[model samples]
Target: MSREKGKEFAEQDLTPMTGAATDVAPLGRQQKPAHELTADEDIDVADWDRVAAMAEFKQLVLAKRKFILPATIFFVVYYFALPALVGYAPGLMSKRVFGVVNVAYLFALSQFFMAWLIAALYVRAANRFDGMAQRIISKLKGGR
Candidate 1:
């Protein structure tokens, strides 16, 4: 296409499709450059500032961070420690266990269980986070 045609196509008003629109976050929305958009653009977030400012929301963020930060740190340390021990402490890792299996093999196998355990813990924690979010939503909707 010609540059002028491309420009016209880019600037053309594309109306959202009829039907299948939701009360929140309607589909087929046209995206524009941030610089080209007006400051007062209607993005349809209802009282988002109030939501962000709500004590419940703040607590929810904090609760998430509390679980996530420690979990992330633990996982990173546990994961990196395997390679470090193998590379630095070969004698310790080479100690035979169960005839053929060794410490390194056992440790490597344990990682799978560790990952599963962490995932299970995260799922449990996520349920609490979801409840916290639901409470915040309820507050926004003028409920207890």
Candidate 2:
């Protein structure tokens, strides 16, 4: 093909396809640079000022608070409820299904597993919460 034809073809190929547009995050969506924060380190005020000005940053802060409250409530309820149920309702819950292992016995034993599972879940969730909190704080404080 002629150079002119090639150029025209390239231009045509570059045209946006109907309903096929890909989502592209702007450059700002990328991760912020790392910073070593210490108790005595001086903070950069400009970054915080910029972040505080953003609506998305405010939403993130609010969302974190929203999740934390419910997570705390759930943790309290499940933590207390499981133990209490196991202790008080053992007879009611008792049922032999696997040899001599009763439902109550299983429920009591399962609490240990439940504790570990809850801990693991909380650790993962809290880590994410910590990240958002730190990000919001850093943005407010002007840290990278």
The superposed Cα distance between candidate 1 and the true structure at residue 84, in angstroms, equals: 0.7
Each prediction's RMSD to truth: 11.7, 17.0
Q: Candidate 2, overall lDDT?
A: 0.58
> Model 2 compared with the native: what TM-score?
0.44
Q: Model 1: what TM-score?
A: 0.70
What C-alpha lDDT do the candidate models reach, one value each? 0.74, 0.58
Q: Where's the lowest-lDDT run of ten residues in candidate 1? A: 1-10
**CA displacement after TM-score superposition, residue 82 of candidate 2 (Å):** 4.7
**lDDT score for candidate 1 against the true structure:** 0.74
Which runs in model 2 stand beyond 4 Å of their true positions?
1-61, 79-91
TM-score list, all predictions: 0.70, 0.44
In candidate 2, which residue pairs get closer than 3 Å at backbone N, Cα or C atoms, i.e. clash? 48-140, 48-142
Residues 31-137, candidate 1, lDDT per residue (tens digit)? 54333346787432234556677898999999999999999999999999999999999999999999989999999999999999999999999999999998876
